[model samples]
Target: MVKIGVLALQGAVREHVRSVEASGAEAVVVKRKEQLDEIDGLILPGGESTTMRRLIDKYDFFDALKNFGTQGKPIFGTCAGLILLASDIVGQESAHLQLMDMKVERNAFGRQVDSFEAALEVKGIAEDFEAVFIRAPYVVEVGEDVEVLAVVNNNIVAAKQGQYLCSAFHPELTDDHRMTAYFVEMVEAAKKELAS
Candidate 1:
């Protein structure tokens, strides 16, 4: 089975693991950067971006994570994860990982009290995807190669760029496994391509 690692440095780790298994793939809680070598793909779960970044650096995962993506391994970033993958973050001096070619704004959706769920029409994925957003960040702009997957209120909420995928909402928070399954498919395809 395809093994998908959920970065356990921060939030929604258990939820993502459950979602990944529900999607028919083996899920691994990746606490150490060395575990990256054991998984076919990685999921950076929703969390406080700054804190997660600190943990990532403290554990010396910053480089390994970037190398994993650069090697063509599929990566799925949710919420803060999306922020980490972005090439640029508004008002930030620099970005983390910088794997995806996009610009994101932190907490573009307002505070925690303003969190809400929306029915999204994720392109090429689902006609109606129930998305859960908590202080979410949206894509402000994307490179020409980025494929916008879902938009909400004129804000880009989900997108795919090459082997990288991101969503401003937490798919694992809901029972919907389609998004996770789609990522599993991406990992499987990439693994096959690598093997060949």
Candidate 2:
């Protein structure tokens, strides 16, 4: 069975774990760097980017998390998690993980009171997924390797680059498992390649 790790730093940890398990994968809450060695894939859940970044560094998980990406394992990041994966952050001095090749604007949508939901037509999935946005960041630009997955109101909200999958909305908050299933499939494929 494929084991997926959810960074339990400061975000929706349990929500992601439930969603991942619902998608047919074993989910583990990753708090320490040693735990990274046991997972097939990782999920960076929705939360405050600043807090997550601080916890990551405080726990000494900064470099280990980045190295995990280089190993070719699929990493699924949602909302603030998406911000961490971006290579560049507009109007922000520093980026978190900087794993994905894209530029993101933190809180591009608006404040907390402006949070909203929408039905998004994502690539690779036939049906539309309901996206929950909470102070979500929008992707301003993507590198050559990045593939835009879903757009809302002319703003890029979801994208994938290599093993990195990101969304500016929180999919785990809803019951829909399509997006999580898509990522689980990516994890399975990577595991297969490693075995071969």
Candidate 3:
């Protein structure tokens, strides 16, 4: 069975673990950097981006997490996680992982009270994916290799670049496991390629 690790530093760790299990994979709550070696893929869940970064640095996971992605393992980021993977962040001097070649604007969906749900037409996934956005960020731009996955109200909410997948809304917040399943498939495929 494939083990999907959810970064337990912050955000919806339990929710993502449950979702990953629902998608037919063993889930691991990755609290330490060494845990990265035991998982096939990683999920960066939604939380306060700055606080998460601080925790990552304090735990000395900053380099380990980036190396994980660089090694061709799949990574799925949602909400604040998306902010971390972005190469450029609006009004910010530097980004966290800088793994994905995209520009993201944090909290582009307004404040916490503006949180809402929308049925998104996620490309190559679902015709109508129920996504929950809470203080979400939208992709302002993406590199040529990036594929836009879903959009809402003219804002880019989901995208995939190579082994990297990200969504502005929290798919784990809902009962839908298709998004998680898709990521699991990505991991499975990457693992096969690496072995070959």
Candidate 4:
């Protein structure tokens, strides 16, 4: 079974764990740099981006994550997780990994009360899936290599960068497992290519 690790530093860890398991992959909470090497892929769940950055710096994981990405291990980020993976952000910037090449507007959709559910047409998933957005950010632009999978209100909300897939909405917050399952497939494919 593929072992997928979710960064437990903060955010929706439990929800992500459940989604990964539901997708038929082994789920592990990655709290330390050492645990990172044991997983096929890593996930950064939705939470406060600034706070998550602080926790990442406090644990000195900022560099570890960048280095891991270089190793070709797929990394998926959702919500605040998406903010961390982004290359540029319009708002606060105390700390960001600058991974994905795009600018995002944090909480661009009003406040938490502005949160809503809507059917999103996502690639690799049949039928429209209801995406849950809570204090979500919006992708203003995407890089050349980035593939936009879903959009809402003309704002980029979901994208895939190479092996990494980041979404502005929280797929874990719902019962849908298609997204996680897609990531699992990516992990398996990457492992296969690496082994060859």
Candidate 5:
């Protein structure tokens, strides 16, 4: 079975852990740099991007986390996590990870009070997936390699680029496990590549 790690630095760590487990993968909460070596894939949970970034720097796991990406393992980011993976944050001067070639606008959906749920037609999933948006950041632009997965209110919310996957909505907050299952499939594929 594939082992997946959710960055436990901040945010909905337990929820993501449950989601990964529901997807039939061994879920681990990643708190230290060494823990990244043990997981087949990683999930950056939805939380305050600035806070998460500060915690990452304090733990001195910034470079280690980025290096983990270089190993070609899948990394999925949700909400503020999406902001971390983005290469650009519109109107913001700094960014975390900068792994995905996309421009994201922070809190594009307004404040926490503006949070709402909607079913979206994701490209890979057969049916509409329930998406929960809370102070989410939407992709304003994508690079050549990036594939837009799902959109809502004319905003790019779900996107994938090679081993990287991002969503402006929190999937762990809902009962649907399709997104996590989709990610597990990506992890399985990457594991196959390594074995071959």
Candidate 6:
């Protein structure tokens, strides 16, 4: 089976692991660079971006992740994870891998009180997914190859760059598995090519 990892340094690690298993893949917690090497893809769970960055720096896993992405491994980032995947960020100063070609504004929806759920029309998802936004970020701009998948109030909140998918909401916290299923398809495709 293809192995997928959850960046377990912080955030909704268990939820992501369960979601990965529900999607028919092996789920592993990736706290170190060595753990990352064994996985075919990764999921950056929702959490405080600053804290996650601190852990990334402390663990010395930033460059290793950048290297992994450069090699074309897939990554799915949610909420704060979306912030890390974006190539640019606004509002607060934070460390990022500068991967996706998008500009994101941290806490774009206001304070924690602003957190709410909305039925979102996301690309590749057959039905509306209940998007749970908790201090989420939204994309202000996207590069040529980055496809905007979903938007809320005209602000981009979901996007995909090649195999790297990102959402400014916590999909792991919901019961819906469409996004997880889509990601699993990505893993399977990647595994197929590798096997070939």
Indicate whether candidate 2 or candidate 4 has the larger lDDT. 2
lDDT of 6: 0.88
Off by over 4 Å in 5: none
Distance from true location, Cα of 12 in model 6, Å? 0.7
lDDT of each residue in 1-196, candidate 2, tens digit only: 7999999998899999999999999999998999999999999998999898989999999899999998898899999899989999998787788899999999999999999999999999635799999999999999999999999999999999989999999999999989999999999999999889
lDDT of 2: 0.93
Task: Write out the backbone clash pairs for model 5.
Answer: none
**How many backbone collisions does model 3 have?**
0
Q: Write the per-residue lDDT of candidate 5 for residues 76-186, one digit (tens) a residue.
A: 999988999999998888778999999999999999899999999999873689999999889999999999999997889999999999999999998898999999999
The better-scoring model by TM-score among 2 and 4 is 2
Regions of model 1 farther than 4 Å from truth: none
Clashing pairs for model 1 are none
- In the range 1-196, model 3's lDDT, one tens digit per residue, is 8899999998999999999999999999999999999999999999999999999999999999999999999999999999999999999998889999999999998999999999989999999999999999999999999999999988899999999999999999989999999999999999999889
State the displacement of the C-alpha of residue 190, model 5, in Å, after optimal TM-score superposition: 0.4
Tens digit per residue, CA lDDT, model 4, 143-165: 89899899898999899988888
Q: Give, for candidate 3, the lowest lDDT window spanning 10 residues.
A: 186-195
lDDT of 1 by residue, 56-90 (tens): 99999999999999999999999999999999999
Q: Which should have the higher lDDT, number 5 or number 6? A: 5
**Which ten residues in a row are the worst by lDDT in model 2?**
123-132
User: Is 1 or 6 the stronger prediction by lDDT?
Assistant: 1
Write down the lDDT of every candidate, Cα atoms only.
Answer: 0.97, 0.93, 0.97, 0.89, 0.93, 0.88
What TM-score would each prediction reach against the true structure? 0.99, 0.98, 0.99, 0.96, 0.98, 0.96
Error of 3 at 39 (Å): 0.6
Query: Model 6: per-residue lDDT, tens digit, 1-196?
Result: 8899999988999999888999889999897798878999999899998899889999999999898788778899999999988878876555398889889999999889999999999987745899999999899999999998998999998899987999998888887878887888887887687668
Please state the error at residue 132 of candidate 5 in Å. Answer: 0.6
